[model samples]
Target: MKKSTLTQDNIWMKEPEEHDFPAAQDYLELLLVPDAAKKIVEDLKKAPTIIKKSKDILRASRLPLLPETNIHVKENLKKVQKNKKLSPILLMRGQNDLIIADGYHRLCCSYYLTEDMDVPCRLV
Candidate 1:
């Protein structure tokens, strides 16, 4: 089967400024979801081995995720009223695209809280 690659037009493919992981971690700490670490683990295990979803493939094309994406997330959250319940972590395989570094809680929460399933992400 020919894989459907991410196109440039995808809104999530927009370029982002450098992410400061330390700062992001600090923010995550403040957000402090209960069982944050464990959830990350479970989320990863739950994620599929062959993740063919176009949304996730688009996310991977961006390479390292941008840190300045929080602003976008806030806006997206307000717009979305229904969560899509997607996988939190998607492994980056085949041609060095991108992978879910961490932060499954933030992704899940952003989708649930804002209802926008297409949030910007970063790779580890």
Candidate 2:
């Protein structure tokens, strides 16, 4: 698909979608025990949203950015072209670096728009 030009503004919903918590829990379960993962997901549900720059998030998380050609990233970029509001990211603080838990694709997609973009997220 041809990509759409994206800006940092109005690209995200004020809060994450309800399904995000479950997805986060699923990912966290891999790194942590199921009980621990569940608790983190619970905490994230109640956590207030905060903004972090795309660059800062990637640096803090120490995660590789998926290329724009990634299927998920490409699909999200298409959503942005249609002005669809994407759910905010869900994150957590791991033992050392930050953990994305969910929304990795969203972060990478936003980075392509501009690393200076402020991404809405709830970090636990």
TM-score of 1: 0.24
Q: Model 1: residues >4 Å from true position, as ranges?
A: 1-99
User: Which pairs clash in the backbone of model 2?
Assistant: none
**lDDT of each residue in 3-62, candidate 2, tens digit only:** 344444568889999999999999999999999999999999999999999999999999
Clashing pairs in 1: 65-122
Query: How far in Å is the alpha carbon of 31 misplaced in model 1?
Result: 25
Per-residue lDDT of 1-124 in model 1, one digit per residue for the tens? 0113222223232322224233334444454454653354344444433313334544555543323346654543333323222223333233555434444333433433323334543332
Q: What is the TM-score of each candidate against the true structure?
A: 0.24, 0.93
Error of 2 at 54 (Å): 0.4
Every candidate's CA RMSD: 13.3, 2.6
